[model samples]
Target: MRPVPKQRRGVTPRARLRVLQLPVVLWLTLVWVALWGELSAANVVFGLVVSIVVCLVFPLPTLPMDLHIRPLRLVWLVLRFLGDVVVASVEVAWITLRFWREPRNAVIEVDLETSSDFVLTVVAEMVSLVPGSLVVEARRSTHTLFLHVLDARDTAGVDKMRSQVYALERRVVRALGTETQRLPEGGTP
Candidate 1:
């Protein structure tokens, strides 16, 4: 009997489709349908085909992420995020109107407690989506995110922003992180 050859480390032909996640493909198809502004069967089929083709042709960079999904925590996190979005939108609009002439902008670096890259990415994305702050740099080695914030007038304001960011990170960790990486109850880490 002949010995069998070892399988390669890279993705196999059958696994190519697996590289494109179901949620991403669905979202892409939805986007295509929305852009065309049509709800016909032909549109749905076309959108699905296009989404699949795009995903196959342009494969995304894979991140080896370790995710632990806590359903109840996730629900709470979503509700809190939505509320924050509304409040931040209003606050930022007010700030823009009030200080159109001399807006206080500052770049602040926040050190995150968790060393997980996935958590870091999630936190950065969430912060960027909140309107007034955008992540300028993320250093994985130091687990620090540098954000450019608008309307932070003074040192106290900057400190407050830092505190808020830390608080957000804490919440994110509590929502999705495993016990090993999560902050303690006393919250001194």
Candidate 2:
């Protein structure tokens, strides 16, 4: 009889791979359900299967992340994001209505304090989701985001947008930052 190989301790590579793929799979499934506009058992099962196939076909490189979730801060971040959306929507509507004037849009570069790619991606997505701004380019090397902002006519407007990006970044870091990540020197807005 052949001797049995000793079982490895801790997580096996396959288990680790599954754990890493879980988030992407779940997110893809959620997106599928959302796109269908209804949640049914069949939809969920199909979505899961499709997501799994997609993940297998185009596997993503996993990053070593030290994510820490603070639920209260996350709720606050969502509320703040919603408020920003409302305010930005009104601003954009007003800008559109003013037919006599050309809206002054500027592409500004914001150097984010956190170097984490996860944080950078979240911040960029949030900024892009708001009505008055969009993330045009992200520089991973410098941890910089270039956003095209509507109605940023002057230096003060540019500064305000820059500060707003920082504030959003601060909120993101507070909500989902790694254990060792430190908030910038100022108190949260």
Candidate 3:
């Protein structure tokens, strides 16, 4: 008699964990708590069925390295994002209010240092979320950011905006990006 070998699924344990690295936090889990109220036999059955259907219909996107996250980093990222939204909203609101006579608007160019596309995107989205400025275009190949500012005084204002983009890039890296060692590292950011 010959023994048969069992089929092996290709998923590695580490890889699987990495794929689901980030937990959705209580903001999402609270949905389950909604089922707790007004529980009769029919209500409970309906709630369970609805929850299952809802989750099945609109599942979260599965990501690689999503499950392999550091909690401290996640906490910091959320806090930073919240703070950015508040500060940026306020700055944009003020910019929107002022009555400036020759609005010298200009497209600001920003060079990124990081190689990660995800980090760059986060930076761009964060910048565009503000009112006075919007990302006109981002050339990922060149790591360049073209932002249209509400107004620009001169070269200095453009330079300042560019610097802000660079700083934003660094923050995104710190938040959700992994550092990559550039080989033959000799290029401007």
Candidate 4:
């Protein structure tokens, strides 16, 4: 008969599980608070309880996190995103005011360089948040985004839209992708 292996002392499986779940619980709690639009002791307590319950009920499969944040790059990404939003908002307003003429729109596909799901999602969300363009579909398998662009009148306009998407993807990858996912400065990966 073989001898049984001894379990480690002090750290129980339940405790290990709680450690693994902490980040998700905290993120959920923060979202809950944001949705409620208020922060109070009671709200925090309730949110924590709800988050814990949700995590326990719907346990998510743990995937290896590929995010590696670069503070300077992240700042650049935010500033550029804000600038894009402002410019896009103005352009969209102009387009809306010109009701006499129908704006030419096109659906363009952009293939992103980074393979990271997190970077892809962030880029898609940022693109969608801009007023003149919307991400109609995202293909994770191909790392591709299909965007509906306003005022894309010709092939040149469509190419511009695709390049813009590529630039956004590059910025996002620079900000939050793993080292391998990041392209060299002024060049593709």
Top lDDT model: 2
Which ranges of candidate 4 are over 4 A from the true structure?
1-20, 30-45, 179-189
Model 3: C-alpha RMSD to truth?
9.8
Candidate 3: tens digits of C-alpha lDDT, residues 45-124: 56555655554445443433322345676677567667867876787667667767556789877878866556667778
Writing each residue's lDDT as its tens digit, candidate 1 over 96-163 gives 78844688899998998777777788889999999889999988777899999988889998998898
CA lDDT scores, all candidates in order: 0.81, 0.85, 0.62, 0.81
Q: Which is the better candidate, 3 or 4, if ranked by TM-score?
A: 4
Please give each candidate's TM-score: 0.71, 0.78, 0.55, 0.78
Candidate 4, residue 16: Cα displacement in angstroms equals 12
Q: After superposition, how far is residue 40 of candidate 1 from its true place, in Å?
A: 8.5
Model 4 CA lDDT for position 140: 79
For model 3, which pairs clash? 18-65, 20-66, 20-67, 21-66, 21-67, 21-68, 22-66
Which has the better lDDT: candidate 1, or candidate 4?
4
Q: Per-residue CA lDDT of candidate 2, range 1-189, in tens?
A: 224334334647685466448889899999999999999999999999999888765655566677789899999999999999999999999999999999889999999988787888889999999999998899888789999999899989999999999899899888885633556576765
RMSD (Å) per prediction: 7.1, 8.6, 9.8, 8.1
Which parts of model 1 have CA positions greater than 4 angstroms off?
A: 1-48, 99-101, 178-182
> How far does residue 182 in candidate 4 sit from its true spot (Å)?
5.3
Q: Could you give me the TM-score of model 3 versus the true structure?
A: 0.55
Model 3 regions lying over 4 Å from their true place = 1-70, 100-102, 180-189
Across residues 63-166, which tens digit of lDDT does each residue of candidate 4 receive?
Answer: 45677788998999999899999998999999999989999999988888777767787889999998888888888787889999999989999998888888
**In model 1, which range of ten residues has the least summed lDDT?**
1-10
Q: Give the TM-score comparing model 4 with the true structure, all chains together.
A: 0.78
